[model samples]
Target: MANPQKPPTAASKSSALASGKLGQIIRLLQRAKGATIDDLTEVTGWQAHSVRGAISGQLRKRHGLAVSATPDASRGLVYRLPKAGGTR
Candidate 1:
């Protein structure tokens, strides 16, 4: 049997936040010019509110990234990196 108390592996962590998965979502939105909560939700398979929380809380607060959304466009808003990379 596996060790229950062992920490998660790097592979697991990467999978959870892989570019192909979450990174791709962010990249697509950035490259798309912008995207709405709905667009992020569709691509990430997350709910709109969850996407909002991740954008606001996780991306903005935690990662020092920015994601914006508006009501008019099909994609909604855009995401951009800070002029200087954030505090990691």
Candidate 2:
């Protein structure tokens, strides 16, 4: 049998959006001014815990995204993307 392909390299994967739950996280970030875990769930139709994983796991761990969450004045938890660079 042929050799199995290695997983995608960091450079290639970093620019590419992760799929499934991860995709939902990226899309929410791209679309919303500041997307919380709740926003991720609303967009992806996933549970809150899963949305949290998508932000903390896929976006932060794999893609090198900088994310922060804090309670808002009215909206409960609010998420910030990239944590640096780019204008909001």
Candidate 3:
């Protein structure tokens, strides 16, 4: 009989996400000013949609990160993680 594979835990997924392009995006989001789609695309060499997907699919969905986007005067949408010790 074949063995079943367990789904990844939040810690493992977070560790995986904390490297490479995803990490880059996280860092940008952690910044006080946050980052726009253009900024994420520029850093990761990905299309705007791809960046959005990474945020929505990978960060928010997979990692269960409460990534939020707020409107900015200079930037259209600034995406970022919520402040530590802050409520979502």
The best candidate by TM-score is: 3
Q: Sorted on TM-score, highest at the top, how do the candidates line up? A: 3, 2, 1
In model 2, the runs with Cα more than 4 Å from the true position are: 1-20, 83-88
Instruction: Please write out the lDDT profile of model 2 over residues 1-88, one tens digit for every residue.
Output: 8999999886666456656656657656665567876677777898988778767787789667877676888878888675235664
- Per-residue alpha-carbon lDDT of model 3 for 57-78, expressed as tens digits? 9888987889989999878989
Write one digit per residue (lDDT tens) for candidate 1, span 4-74. Answer: 78798868765665455467556655653456565677788988777777777766786556655545554
In order of lDDT, best first, we have 3, 2, 1
lDDT of each: 0.61, 0.71, 0.88
* Runs off by more than 4 Å, candidate 3: 1-12, 83-88
Error of 3 at 52 (Å): 0.5
Q: Is candidate 1 or candidate 3 better by TM-score?
A: 3
Q: Comparing candidate 1 with candidate 3, which one achieves the higher lDDT?
A: 3
Full-model lDDT, candidate 3: 0.88
Look at candidate 3 and tell me the lDDT of residue 28.
91
TM-score against native, each model: 0.55, 0.66, 0.78
Candidate 2: lDDT over CA atoms?
A: 0.71
RMSD of candidate 3 to true structure, Å: 2.8
Q: Pick the candidate with the highest lDDT.
A: 3
